[model samples]
Target: MSQKNNKKRPKSRSWRGLFRRRSDPHRAYREKYLETLQYQHRTFDVKGLTTQGIFTLELARVFVDLGLGQMGQRPSTDPIPRFAPAQQRERHSIWEYLTSESLQNHNLAVLGAPGSGKTTLLKHLTLTLASPESLPESVQGMPRMPILLLLRDYAAIIEEEPDFSLLTAVKQELARREENIPLDWLAQDLQNGRCLIMLDGLDEVAKPQLRRQVVAWVERQMQLYRNNRFIITSRPFGYRNNPLNGVLVLEVRPFTPEQVRQFIHNWYLANEIKSAGHDDKGVRLDARQGAEDLLVRLRQTPVLLDMSVNPLLLTMIATVHRYRSSLPGRRVELYEEICEVFLGKRHEARGILYDLTPAQKKRVLQPLAYAMMLHKQREISIEEAMAIIDEPLSRVSPHTPRNEFLRMIENTSGLLVEREVGMLGFAHLTFQEYLTAVHVLDQRLEHELVQHI
Candidate 1:
């Protein structure tokens, strides 16, 4: 009887082992999904331009120290000791400080103006956490998965489901990314403090009501997912009310002269490698000359320096300077030149010709710009954008098909971008503002204001 029982036990165990060996479709899908995500989001898509650069966040972040108090001031609870060690007084990257803390109770709000490298910093952080090899010494060996959620996308989700939550939104995002991760697995990871949530672009929420909801949702997420780390980003004005509680607010500092110089050097060095041929020496020489010229301009002109301190503008300056061999003297002139470059000259220089002239394109875009400004919108639907082009298209070129014209504008014009499917926004907020300013001036609003004053 004992021998028979033992034999039955072995058979049952073998059957169970065989069942386990069978392939799990869900598990297989998850493994492939992770690989795909690692391939897709492992690097920053610099400037959202076809001419992209691969830069680590460590290189992009300016090391500015902050005291943990109100609006970057000294902490209320403590005073600095006069004889404190030099190391304690030294500056550190916000990234370093953030990792050093007990994140279970900590949340961070990173505020910066448009084109101020906020997104870039977030991207760097995501990539670093996502890719273990890129992790800093302090965060190394930590078991965590970084999930990056564009708040604009999250706001849209909340609109669809009034009862939506941060975790649900994250699950939706993972699904969109084609990741087949199970909710149980995600919940386990979150509960174990193995997740870093990076919520980017709170400012991109176009509506105030929607933005406020997003803020509330974020604050709730911090409480609910108390074990995990969280970082939220926004433009300064967008976060004026200080919505998130128990949060450290850190502002991204403008690039200093030395940092700017280093950036230029790195930019040229990276680009020169791509442009190099058999004569590498000539490419290097030209790159050095370009960097030197840009540095000289930044040093000599305060206005130019002011513009160059922001990474987006500086990158554009570098891009324009690389191709054009000169920068416009005035700020408006620079924008105008940039507009023209995007409209026609950039394509022409690349030996591609679009049918629309720069003037015709400008006429078509001006009314759209004006509408966006009047409505206080940063993004527009494709249908609305086409309607905007229709009025100008009729006046400038009556024969132009609206669809064809819109396609051409999107393809050749660097000024406009398709932020998501069926949606569009200016390449940068600054471009939108510049175009809106031009529209206002053209309408004689400046003269009317002066008269009223």
Candidate 2:
């Protein structure tokens, strides 16, 4: 009976084990959590054309190859509504900006246009600080625990439950992927000034009231926890108030020509490694050739090169060009090829019995696009959209399902997006214009152009 009673307790629950864990409870999990975060944030998915058809690549695998970018700090002396830096705002390498005294010294607000890689910039900081394999030479100092939260999620929670605690929101975001991190550990780290909290996309909160709430909550937290470093990102338009205290403001400059060149080269290398699974030497060689050739092609298309400074447009251009590698060097050919890519999205071979042919579907969108242009409307109501698309779709597919067709366009092809809850719009104005031209030309409606004008 004594032997049974004295049987060794599991090592995990032993008194010594309990004391050891208590002595440094947060350290054990915090270190593990940092590694977990590194793994989770290290890879980013890029969706577009690849050698092996539409693919998503780990863009960060080659992030270092492109090098860290610089941010231009907005001096408060600069007048409000002044863009283009009337005076040269001080520039710092993003790595230096984060690791130096600046981050610990003052809260930061980074503003840029949509699609200028604002999220990527914040994420780069997150990935680098969270148990990085190596640090950029420009970076210095000890690592801080990174806590990345989308402000939209918090806004959503608050929109639903306005009284939700900010700490609870952070805890919820941390646990979102079932990370199972202890709330106590997070709170302790935050209190001790060990966390780098990044709140991304003030613009995405969307509703004005919700954005105000988010702004207020952030300000409150900053006031309460002055020790911890914080970073906020948004579009230039979303952050007009300049509400946060002692915040350094910065803007993400457009990618320089050298940056554009390097980013594309590494981007393709990442894609080649991920999609084609080529040998390293072969992959590098192909990636170099592919990137250079793409640049040459883009250079020929002035319209594309003009938008290349934007990382989002640059990525889209790379994706579209890779898919349409054989496009004839003509302006019309570029638009036509783009249309073809949109037409060939997952709808082409869903293997479903009700799948509509890409050509038939394209025709329906073409006329609808034409109608939007005719009305000078950015978006159309769902009911008006059905009325326009139904007759055209019925002409091609007598048994077409109206709701399913709209769903395919919205979800699968991404040709049309829900601009509002019930209003549908072409994904881009260019899409509408190109499709309008196609509709007018193909259907012999050129005469109507003069009448509409």
TM-score per candidate: 0.59, 0.65
Q: Deviation in angstroms for 442 in model 1?
A: 4.8
Residue pairs in collision within model 2: none
The lDDT values for all models are 0.61, 0.63
- Candidate 2, residues 248-358, lDDT tens digits: the string is 777666565677788788778877777676647887888788899988977776556655766755766776566667522544654554455455532122221225666
Q: CA shift at 280, candidate 1, in angstroms?
A: 7.2
For candidate 2, the per-residue lDDT at 262 reads: 80
Scored against the true structure, residue 311 in model 1 reaches a CA lDDT of 68
lDDT of 1 by residue, 1-453 (tens): 001111110001121222245474344433443455465565433433333343332333322222221244321101101123332334346556454433324567876544556666666565555444344566643334666788876686776665677667767877787775666655655776667788987766756688888888787787777767788887654576546887767665556566678778767765665566333777778778878988887777655565675665677777666655556554565677657756766435434355677877887887788778777788899899988888779988899888777755654453666656777777656677777778778876776434533
Q: How many clashes does each candidate structure show, in the order listed? A: 0, 0
Give the TM-score (vs. native) of candidate 1: 0.59
Off by over 4 Å in 2: 1-24, 47-54, 62-91, 100-103, 136-138, 160-163, 241-243, 276-279, 326-445, 448-453
